[model samples]
Target: MKPTITITYCPKCGWLLRSSYMATELLTTFADELNGVLLKPAETAGEFCISIDGEPLVDRKAAGGFPEITALKRLVRDRVAPDKSLGHSDRVHAKPDSGKDEK
Candidate 1:
């Protein structure tokens, strides 16, 4: 199975500042973008600061400011699906139908 990873984000600015890519394939696909922002793998296990266009996007010390992160997680979760044939084992199963849950 593909490695399970966590992605953290700011809840205010709608910026996607941090993500974890445990799978080599996923990391390779996102390497360019991660490198563009200087996003590297976490070393210790604490929040890290992130910036874009010289503007502060994430303040790991502060409380609010990560709406961007939340939105990004939602977007990714809603958009990407794993390919089992490609040796990708991680799967986000579709939510089962429930009459009251239908929108």
Candidate 2:
């Protein structure tokens, strides 16, 4: 069975828009793999978390901040479609190290 992704965000903290945006991105990216993305309004203040099938994938409090969209997509892709490629999103941002002489 396909897995469901849930984004729980604190409504009081004005995180609903953020959560909804994430849900849209996940749904679009994982249309073939995910059953759906659920936007859950968190009861706890300042709470924001993403999970797959009730298993926590990331917690804002623990991570100290919200994850970038690219990072979040990579995390979800890893679990839902391990063999899938993320194209530009998967590209490393840092320049590659060149062992050869640069002179």
- Candidate with best TM-score: 2
Q: Count the backbone clashes (under 3 Å) in each candidate.
A: 9, 0
Q: Name the best candidate (by lDDT).
A: 2
Collision pairs in model 2: none
Error of 2 at 73 (Å): 0.7
Please give the lDDT score for candidate 1: 0.38
Off-target runs (Cα >4 Å) in candidate 2 are: 96-103
Clashing pairs in 1: 10-66, 10-67, 11-66, 11-67, 12-65, 12-66, 12-67, 14-68, 15-68
TM-score of each: 0.26, 0.90
lDDT of 2 by residue, 65-93 (tens): 99999999999999999999988999988
Each model's lDDT comes to 0.38, 0.92
- Stretches > 4 Å off in candidate 1: 1-35, 40-47, 64-68, 72-103
Worst 10 residues of 2 by lDDT: 94-103
